[model samples]
Target: MIEIVEKGVTNLELSKHLIKRLNYTQWKRINRFEFAQIF
Candidate 1:
């Protein structure tokens, strides 16, 4: 039971990291100067 909890936590952390990285990549592809102007 304790091991399962640890695994779940690790999986969640990994998922969060992946999502952050993906968002950063998408953000970088945009024109930063215009991004703020449009948003």
Candidate 2:
């Protein structure tokens, strides 16, 4: 119960870290394109 919740939180943090590390460039590009489309 508590342990499961802790594990889930840990996994979420890990995945967030990984996405930031792996997709930072791609994310920036997408944001730029999105901003360009809007403006």
Per-residue lDDT of 1-39 in model 2, one digit per residue for the tens?
356446666644544554667767775565545544542
What are the lDDT scores of the predictions, listed in order?
Answer: 0.56, 0.53
Candidate 2 off by > 4 Å: 1-9, 24-39
The C-alpha RMSD of each candidate to the native structure, in angstroms, is 11.0, 9.7
Worst 10 contiguous positions by lDDT, candidate 1: 10-19
For lDDT, the strongest prediction is 1
Give the range of the ten consecutive residues with the poorest summed lDDT in model 2: 30-39
After superposition of all CA atoms, the RMSD between model 1 and the true structure is 11.0
What would the per-residue lDDT of candidate 1 be over residues 1-39, giving only the tens digit for each residue?
Answer: 355446665644544554576777775685646654542
